[model samples]
Target: MTSVWDLPDFDDHEVVHFVHDRISGLSAIIALHSTALGPGAGGTRFWHYAHREHAVTDALRLSRGMSYKNAMAGLPMGGGKAVILADENGTKTPEMLAAFGDAIEGLGGRYVTAEDVGITDADMVAVSQRTRYVSGLPVSDASSAGGDPGPFTSHGVYLGVKAAVAEGLKTDSVRDVRIAIQGVGSVGSGLARLLTADGAKLVLADVNNDRAAALAEELGAEHVASDAIMGVDADVFSPNALGAILDEKTIPGLKPKIIAGGANNQLAKAEHAQLLHRQGIVYAPDYVINAGGIISVALEYLAQRDGEPCSREQVMERVGRIPERLKAIWQESAERDMPAANVADAMAQKRIGRA
Candidate 1:
C-alpha cells in the first residue's frame, strides 16, 4: 500500500487522523488540509469505499478542496473533512454516530463537521450531542441560515450556469437553451427546477433511473441514460455527481460549450483543466460555484459560536456573489490564456497564504 504522504492528493495536509472504535464498529478518517485562516470546517461524508486507501485519498482531496472553497468564499474557516467507512451493505447506526461524534469531540474544536454525501442534518444533530463543534443542524425556523445546505448549493449553481451561458454563449437568457444535467439528486434536481422555470430545455440523467425519469416527467424535460448524458448535444452540461468524472477519458466526448455544476473536485488532475480549456469549454471551478452550502453552514457555525443570528436572506446575499466571483475568474482566464480552475486556484492559494 502507498503511504499517505506519498499519495498525489496529499497536499501538505496539516493533520490526518485515522479513527477506530471496535465496539461501535466505527472506522473513519479525519483530514485537516489547513488551519491558516481559522479552525478547519467542513462536512462529514459516510460512504462505502471498496478500498480503505480510497477513503484516505477522498479525505485528502475533499479536505483540500474545502480549504480552497472556504478561502475563496471569504469565510473565516479553514478546511477539513471526515469520511466514515461504511460496510458493504452501507449500514449506519446510532452507535456509529455517537462514536464518530466522540472522536470529533476529541479533536478539541480544530475540526467542525456538518452534512455531506450519505450524511444528514439530523445526523449532525446526533453528533452535536457529543460536541459543540458541529453545524447543519435542523433549524426551527425556515428563515434561519442553518439546515440542509442542498438548496443553497443549488441556487449558487443555477446562478453560475446562467453566468456561464452569458460568458460562453454570449447570451443572458437560458430560455430555449438546452442544458444536460448529470445526477438528478438534491442539488441537480433543484437546479433543474430553477432552470425549467426560466424556460431552459432540459435533459436529465442519474444513476437512479426512477428518480431521473420522474424528474424529467415532472419538468417536461427529456431523460437519458447516465452514460449517454455527456454525449448529448446541449449548450451546457451540468455535472452534479461525484468527483474525478471530468478526466481524460470523458472530457473529449463532452459536447457542451460550458461545463459548470456543484460537484467538488471535478478535475481528476490539475492538467484536466487545461484539457477543458483546449476543448473551448468554459469551466466553472467546482469549489467556487459550490461554495454556497459551505457558506451557509459556516456562517451558521460562526453565528452560533458568537451567539448571534444568521438569517437565510444573509446567506442568499452571500451566495449571490458566486456568479460574480466566477465571472472574475473567467475574465482572468481569458486575459491570461489560463484555465479558470487555475486562475481560481491561484487566487485561493494567495488568500490562504499558500502562494
Candidate 2:
C-alpha cells in the first residue's frame, strides 16, 4: 500500500500512469499490465471508491486481468485498464471525459480505451472526441462489430455457463437447470434472458433491487438479496458483479456444482482457487470465459486500424470458441489435480511470455 510495487495486486505492471487534472476534476489511474503482444487494450471504469487505495487496487487488479483476458482470447492486444475515481455523488462531466481522453492520447497508442462498468458508449464517444485510441463506439449498422460490448460479453458467459453445466453435470442441456446470478446489470441481465429462453430456472440478484425484481418478474425467475446470492441452492452460481467474492469467507457456503460468470478477478487471491477445487466445484476461469467483450472491441479496433470492416459474424465466431477454451481449462484442472483458475493462469502466462 505504501508503494505500488508493494501492493498485492500490482503484478509487475509495465506502466502505471496517474493523471490528475484539477480544472476538469479528472483523477484517474491507467495501469498497463503488459504490451508484449501488442498495444495494451482494455476499458475504462468509472466508479466511486470509498478510499483512494481501493481505487488503486482495482486499477491494478483489473489491468492485470485484462492482460490475461486479451492473451487468452487470441487478440493481438495485450492488457491494460483505466479507473476514473468518482466522488461520493459519482459526478462526471464532458470536461472530465475530454481530459481523460487527452491522457489516453498522450499514451501514444500504447493504450486503447473503451467502456466498462459505470461507463457507457456515449461516454466513450465523448472520450473519443479527444483521442483516436478509443473504441466501443456506436455503430451505424447492427451487423457491424462495434458498440457496447455487453451483449458480446453476455453471449460468451452464457456459452461458458452451458459449457460448465455440460462438463460438471455431464449433460449438454441447460433445461431446468438452476442458476443463481449475482448482479443483474447489462451483462448479467443479458445472460439471464438467454438462459431463460433456454429453459433454465434462474435466481437473480443485484445491488439495484428494483432492477433484479423487474428482470425476475419478466423472466418468471426468483429474486433474492445480493448478499444472499452465494448461498442459493443451485446448479451453477454465476457472479456477474464485482470481484473477490469467492474467498475463504464465501466458498464454503457455495451450493453450486459449477462457478462461471463474466466478472473479472472473481478470486480474491491466487490461493483461493484451490479452496474451490477442494470443495469439488468446477470453475470456469473468469478471464477465459469473460473474453467476449474484449474480443469484440479488439477486433473492432484492429479492423479500424487496418481500414477494414468488422462483421458481427466474425465477433460471434470468436465468442463461440469460449466454451472450447473452458473445456480445455477444466480438462487440465482434472488431469493435473489443479484448480481451473491456476491452470488458466498458467496458460495465459505462457501466452503473454511471462511463463
State the lDDT of candidate 2 residue by residue for 103-141, as single tens digits. Answer: 999999999999999999999999999999988899989
The reply for model 2, stretches above 4 Å from the true place, is none
The residue-by-residue lDDT of candidate 1 on 160-232, one tens digit each, is 9999999999999999999999998889999999999999999999999899999999999999999899899
TM-score, structure 2 vs. true? 0.99
Per-model lDDT: 0.95, 0.95
User: Could you tell me how far off, in angstroms, the CA of residue 65 lies in candidate 1 after the best superposition?
Assistant: 0.4
Off by over 4 Å in 1: none
As for candidate 2, its clashing pairs are none
RMSD of each: 0.7, 0.6
My TM-score estimates for the predictions, one after another, are 0.99, 0.99
